[model samples]
Target: MKTILLKSGYSIPVMGLGTWLMNGRECFDSVLMALENGYRHIDTANAYENEDDIGQAIQTSGINRKELFLTSKVWYQKLRFKDVIDQCHSSLEKLRTDYLDLLLIHWPNKFIPMNETFKAFEKLVEEHLVRSIGVSNFTINHLEEALKSTVLPIAVNQVEFHPFLFQKELYQYCKEKQIVIIAYSPLARGKVFESDLLQKIGQNKDTGPGQVALAWLIKKGLVVIPKSSSEEHIIANLGALSITLSDQESSMIDNISENQRFINPSWSEFDA
Candidate 1:
């Protein structure tokens, strides 16, 4: 697996297993299969509610904890100082780990002062509870606010990104600031297969559309976490690492016209 170095001096896998809707036995089996088959990064969150199953999978895999990069997020509603601490400890307990490689603010909550939330994040880092901290679903405005709120480096920004919704401006901003962008929904919730362009690229490359999508993001130096519970898909998705895109192929995907978004809550401030 390839990795990108973070501003915090830590590295994260370029592609990871995304466990969003997966749960129980399915989550365990999928995670176990991923770990056994070369995936070293596992992305989950409190909202996913499958940390315990992932914990079991990791424990059963017999892989050293230090060898894997585990990332979890604090929910948007839990940004209060005490709530942040309590939620992180809860996540650690559920994930069966003493520390997290990366912890993030799942979403930007306007009601929560960025300073207070980042203060709790800093406290976690100071106590060796979290290695690095970041945010998710944040716009450039939100990131500017986050940059103003903390002295610690904002190591990453996990967001919904794919061919259809290429956030070029935000991507460049984070790049210049040294904040890695983790592309969740890198497949656009299965819509990748519907794209004639991605399908054409995949056919030309002899790979699936999903792999093409992941490869495109990887080519742009972004980390991707595409979710799957099927062992076949999991193994196939891992093959994305081997894909090498030509400049014209990359350009075709970049010019995709749709500005579609798959995940958006009523509270989202994407325009802001």
Candidate 2:
């Protein structure tokens, strides 16, 4: 597993298993499968409602706590200072861990003050409850405000990133700030299988569209957490690490005409 050094001075696995929209026996099985396979990183969140399942999987795998990297997020509605602290503690209890490798704001809540949320984050870092802190689904404006609101380094910004919905400006902004970008929904929610270009690239590489999409993101120095419940697909997603895309191939993916964003919600302030 390739690792990237975070601004917080911790190394994070570039590839992680994303546990979203999964729960019960299915979540437990998928998480255990990922750990057994070559995965050392796991991503979950309060909203995902599967932290307990992931904790059970970790216990079953018998992997040392120090050997795995776990990430979780606080829901936007819980951005109050006390709520943030309580949420982190609750998440840790549910995950059966003393500390989280990385904690993030699941979404930017315009109604909540950024400094108040970050104050809780700073307290967590001080108390050794969280190793690093970050934000998810934040735009450039939101990031700028976050930067101003905290003294600690913003280690990462996880977002909906893939070839089709490539966020060039936000990517550049984070790079300038030395913030690692984690690509969630890196496969475009299975839309990769529909792209003729990705299919052709996969054929050339003797892999598949999913691998091609993941390889492109990896080649760009971003981390990816692609979710899957299928054992075969989970293992196949890891094969992307071995793929080496040529400049032309990468550029071809860059020139993709689609700019679709699939995960938008009514409360999202994407345009704001």
Best by lDDT: 2
The lDDT values for all models are: 0.93, 0.95
Question: On a 0 to 1 TM-score scale, where does candidate 2 land against the true structure?
Answer: 0.98
Can you write out model 2's per-residue Cα lDDT over 110-159, one digit (the tens) per residue?
88899999999999999999999999999999999999999999999999
TM-score of each: 0.97, 0.98
Error of 1 at 31 (Å): 0.7
* Alpha-carbon shift of residue 43 in model 1 (angstroms): 0.7
Model 1 accuracy (lDDT, Cα) = 0.93
What is the RMSD, in Å, between candidate 1 and the native fold over all Cα?
A: 1.3
Number of residue pairs clashing in candidate 2, backbone atoms closer than 3 angstroms, sequence gap of 3 or more or interchain: 0
Per-residue error at 266 for model 2, in Å? 1.5
Provide the lDDT at 209 for model 1.
94
Q: After superposition, how far is residue 105 of candidate 2 from its true place, in Å?
A: 0.4
TM-score of 1: 0.97
Off by over 4 Å in 1: 269-272
